[model samples]
Target: MTRLWNDPADFADEMIDGFVAANTRSVQRVPGGVIRRDAVPEGQVAVVIGGGSGHYPAFGGLVGPGLAHGAAMGNLFASPSAQQIHAVAAAAHAGGGVFFSYGNYAGDVLNFDAAQDRLRREGIDCATVVVTDDVASAPADQASLRRGIAGDLIVFRIAAAAAEAGAPLAEVARVAARANARTRSLGVAFTGCTLPGAAAPLFTVPERRMAVGLGIHGEPGIDETDIPSADALAEQLVARLLAEIPDGASAAGGRVVPVLNGLGSLKYEEMFVVYRRIARALEEAGIDIVDPHVGEYCTSFDMAGVSLTLFWLDDELAALWDTPVDTPAYRRGAITRLTDAARNASGDGRATASAASVDSTPDADDASRRVARTVLRAVQEMSRTIDTHVDELGRMDAVAGDGDHGIGMQRGAHAALRAAAEAVDAGAGAATTLAQAADAWSDRAGGTSGALWGVILAAIAAELGDTGTPDAAAVARGVHGAAEGVVAYGKAEIGDKTMVDALVPFAYALTEGTATRPLADAWIAAAATAGAAASATADLLPRRGRARTHGAHSLGTPDPGAHSLALIVTAVGSVLAAPEEES
Candidate 1:
């Protein structure tokens, strides 16, 4: 699709115009597209940084009260020219002098060094610090040649705080250099992103694969492999960074601050999943994390990936890193309640529980149950039919997802059936049997869909228990409850093109059809609606879920989960519609 930019040549100028226009009170464009604001107190030393655009909040977004004084912006993924860098330095320099900071990219080095030379010749004291933190960018012996990633934020904050405290220009540079020494980062990408107005991605990873160590600007990665689970990815990243740190010393003394940054297009939820794993890994390694930040601090437009940054801290730099700083992109030192000891203890315990809780009894009914049961049965039947071809349903999931779906579902279903049969053998009603089934399903299937499905079945059983009898209206209520459960658990809605796309419509159809027809008739109509809804998903671009990484490739492929839901509904209808003697 075409972008709002008039052309590639005008893209940078247009972007800067919009940036300054929107941030008039906070920033202004100096000559050469450098963005600056008058330093907060006006007399403190000034920090200036310059780099290519795209890595927002780095060179430009960091310019503020406790960060940078000026930022020179360049064309997308291209370093700002030497002239531009010089202009930003001159604008930010106070009588105390200017401290220039930038990532270690060849273009940035050549240009910023030239600007530094020019500034010194003109009698303006200028100092420069290059960030080299990306472990995957170079071997240990060639650490100085590594590319910078999110650690730039930590280094910039330290330098800016020194400048804000009215430190000498040389001192500010020293603090920045020290911060850079303690920081390390690594990144992985599932897919590349497009430039504005571009027809195709700047780079590409193979379908259903991930490229690790990818540069933000679309540089080739270390290697491409089948997409790993969040836990696996986090383990890999944290291990590499930990190895980069000196033995027996925290990069931040005994404390560490982590930044889990999304490259772009990765959802906040997915990032948190990665964070959970990283936190566990760090804790295992005896690293104390004083604070953690996770978000899209840097981006390649719409790329589906993320990076991890770790900052080791000394008392002085840590104090500066914690200093009150506010900018459009970031905020620190906001007075949140001091974490209570009990609460902190509980919080740590909760992570363990979350990991262990997968085997617990399913919660009350929600939309997910109704939808999950329908999808589960359908997937089970599909597996039966495809069983001769392959041994497991996970293989089917592997066709489109992480390949755990088949094993997870089979295990959950087997658990559910066993639980149900035991309950039934104990003279329990269908409701009790179903509830037991739900608990078993949840306990066996531990990932996202597993918990969701478990909640759904248990909820349906609970609703049935409350009513004491099963009929058309009761079935309708059960379906409604199932839909609610899924929504509550997954938090996905219709157009996100998740299972909700089919479930929501099917639930509505069940309620309407049951009100006007027999139970079997209602189920048939609901199944038809569900099938249509599942088919309709083919036209939608997935806004969430693993499918999002595939972008346009995801379009025209019925969401497997949704399709499975339709199949389950159809199967249940057949069972309910059977002859009385046969039933």
Candidate 2:
């Protein structure tokens, strides 16, 4: 039931047939099952890449003007036969000779080596490069034994560029080998993927858990753990990659390019969230990120996971990366540098802290301090509530989720409030206090909501720190900061039925002259809108987040997490707007 295939025995042949049919203009199927295509400047050096059928666009699909000149496509999760590889080598050779490249799988090695020997016997000059980039697959002493993941793209591209530039077969192979040596990859999978026509998945994963370092063919992962938030997940992946890269590997004189890739079926929003974290993590680690690529460069048949690839560049490989290459699936030389421009345009070429800008002038009513106190009190109260309802929340989540919401929220809120109180008592400035509080909450809570809430509090405090007031303009700016923080951290948009549903409208409302209106009025409007948006989620299938797995069952139940956020925001507004006498 998991895989749909009419004839299991002929699935491999049928898949190849379809591939050739679709790519007829670009690729030709030769005898022995090798697919050959034309690269730029034919008769120059030849770049060949090959792998199993399951990883489409990898070996075969990459054969084009800017990619591989030929590919020996194999069966699903199986290596191509030696004869198939030899046939492709013969068909692709254009006098300059051929450079063979593929992943470092056992079968691939056996077959490619045999094919290389046969080619040499025929008086053809040939070389080989095996890609082994998965750091989790093996230790540094045995990096060659690790499996290749998304990082294969970097290797393939480097080889193709070198070959297209008329490098000899030996030099082309050297470039690819160098890239493979510098490259490293790691991945985490939340679910297993089923091969076509198979009734069961290739592997198994526990409900609500994830497997780190899962192979493309559903191979066993290196480690298993609870599913983490996108930020945590990205951090874990990037940290592992950083540790693997040699010291000074990403320095100014060094070459480092980052690639954020999805396993399969991961939404673009989620991918973007992962990229945001990876970028931040790399920057913090003093790794200069260059030539970043983000997308589904590699896949595992709808597996819900992501991988990170780091290519430590040298001068030669960097030149190849900068080379122009265009293909149906991959493109280089046209990527815009908008991120750098946007960053520089924002004043100091650095991300502005929302609180730092607002801390200059205190509000006439001292509303900033009062609101901070109120927020702390609310978090404290919510912590107690969460402790009381932990069992109930766990039971509710258990019906369809991981059952950690209650505990996560309680821990996160408690940490935030405790940190805030301590900062205040220690005479820490508002912005510093909020940042500390946010960090504490995020460290303790450890979930999606924890990160989001931490970002929100930090942004609010940063904005207040800049102006030290609660004027109309300041409130608007604070709302903007909060919204941006939520988006930056959560990557949820206006209609994803996330906390954004409430927070966005509230922020927009403040932008309209309604900022001077009582905080309760604005909060009520925002909460009501959010509640409506949350209710609307009943009609939409969950697209992102923990609720995605339930499918239709997720419909008709207001997202509990979003509902909780609405309640908290409304409570804060009410407290802030209340008259002194009422308090």
Candidate 3:
């Protein structure tokens, strides 16, 4: 088990601070993440890459010359908020446009798309290429649904090389996408990883057994089998990758880069031994190996796992692969180091936007302020509810998905509670208070559920205007709007075994109940409906998010997202039933 941490919630920020301090010559600290300390030429396209923070060298260590220009680091196993991504992109931007790339996870997609749209609205050109290289995650016919793993290094290197060579934004994006399409990776683990302050590992495997197709986020593996010998494991990895060669690429006589990556706890000596057999296997198949890599490139926090990636190279890609790189973790060829004076001349290059303070409260009357107080109390109740059931939620999610849903919801709820209190203290109206709380929840949590909750709360806040008292019908309309917003934003249906399964039912029941019942009574009935719907999700297979790949494993477990939402709504009903004077 992992040890060492003060306040697990603050671990990511503290780690980033120490990293920037140690790598001052290579990178400088920004609000959201790190950027290269060296100066770049005018009109050079900035290559920004990132994901969750647990994958160390993957994100921050790659921020330097000939690699990512900047990296937007998020919390442990979580995607960064849209505001954080935008900040990193803006700081990394020169006169040229920004190019974004990362693993194709749900949270990363939602936040990156939002930041890309925001940048476009501000007149800054942007393009994206999401890496989908893990062949084990999806079938070849549905390759677009796969997630990225160790192959991130190959794609990031090629794209950053193109950008460094002064290629336009479109060309850089094209090369990155091409590189991703040609790369394939598969991973297996002997044991699961433990998050900081956690009582146990995310999931466990029987002794002498290995889990196959495990994700980097502590997600449970899709299948398991008895352990194999080093040579046999290497052959298995090579055969699986060779089975899914990209179209027009021949395994025989093809040029490929084989990367034997150790997840985290695996020793370099073990990986080298495995790579020896991998090299022999490829050579025996008449394939030529180029720039073979054996070491840690991307990793889980402490997983004893290894993944092998094969990058099929065309002529252009082969040429680009020879580019010199100088980063904190990975380096190639000889390159001149930047002088102290030159590095000193260049500051952080951050271009930050000014934010409004809590003291500047929106205009409101007595009735709206009263409702805002109730909103604050409701948030407090939700936080307490999450704290009480956090462990249970984590256990449920660990059945198939990454076991961080409980911690994520706890982070979001606490952040929202604090923001609501601040807004209430500033004499804000219900709309402003709830809106601020929504932004806080999304910003701090930084996951799929976080983004969805932000959408839901923001829609309701819009319906509950600041000026007058919102009636029962207006409240029902707000709930309906929230349901619509979640559907449009998350793209999940009721039977997808996600939060939508419960949220949609609750919204509909509440709308019908409010026609003849009081607001509090209607909410109580809707909360019961949500609870039943959440329970029913156990019979459905997940069609979205990280759980989709491990569908069979989640057959008897309810989705943690849906269950958490049900819990929150039920808790809020009690707050709404409080005395009128207290509200």
In terms of lDDT, the best-performing candidate is 3
C-alpha RMSD of each candidate structure in angstroms:
22.9, 23.7, 1.6
lDDT for each residue of candidate 3 in 312-430, tens digit (9 for 90 to 100): 99999999999899999999886686797765576534523233233578799988998898889999999999999999999999998889999989999999999999998988999
lDDT by residue for model 1 (1-583), tens: 2246676545766887787777754566775454444333445677887677767666666766677777878666666656567766776665777788877764566567667888889988888899888888678887776777787888888998898788888899898988888888999998876666555565678998998877776664766788988899999999888877844355332788889999878999999999999998998888788779999887776788999998887788778887777665777765222234543443322111111122333332433333334333433443343323222333333333333344445445666766765554454555656776776665444344455666667666665652234667876887789999888656678988777899889999999998889988988888999999998987888665444434465566777667656666776677666643453
Minimum summed lDDT over a 10-residue window in model 1 is located at: 348-357
Indicate the TM-score of model 1.
0.56
lDDT, candidates in the order shown: 0.69, 0.67, 0.90
lDDT, candidate 2, equals 0.67
Full-model lDDT, candidate 3:
0.90
Q: List the candidate numbers ranked by TM-score, top first.
A: 3, 1, 2
- Residues 1-583, candidate 2: write the lDDT tens digits: 2356777435667877777778665565664343334333446766777766666667677776667777777655556656567767777777788788887764566567767887889888888888889887667996655777888898999998888787888788888888888888998888876666544555568998998877776665767899988899888988787777754365334457988888776788998988998888888777777888888777767677788888997777788888776554666765222244443453431111111112322222344455556555555555666667655554443333334455556666777778878755555545556666776665455445655666677777666562254554665677779889787656577766566776777677656645456555765676566666656655666544534433454556555566556556666655556653465
Query: What TM-score would each prediction reach against the true structure?
Result: 0.56, 0.56, 0.97
Q: Give the TM-score of candidate 3.
A: 0.97
- What are the runs in model 3 whose C-alpha is more than 4 Å off? 344-348, 351-359, 580-583
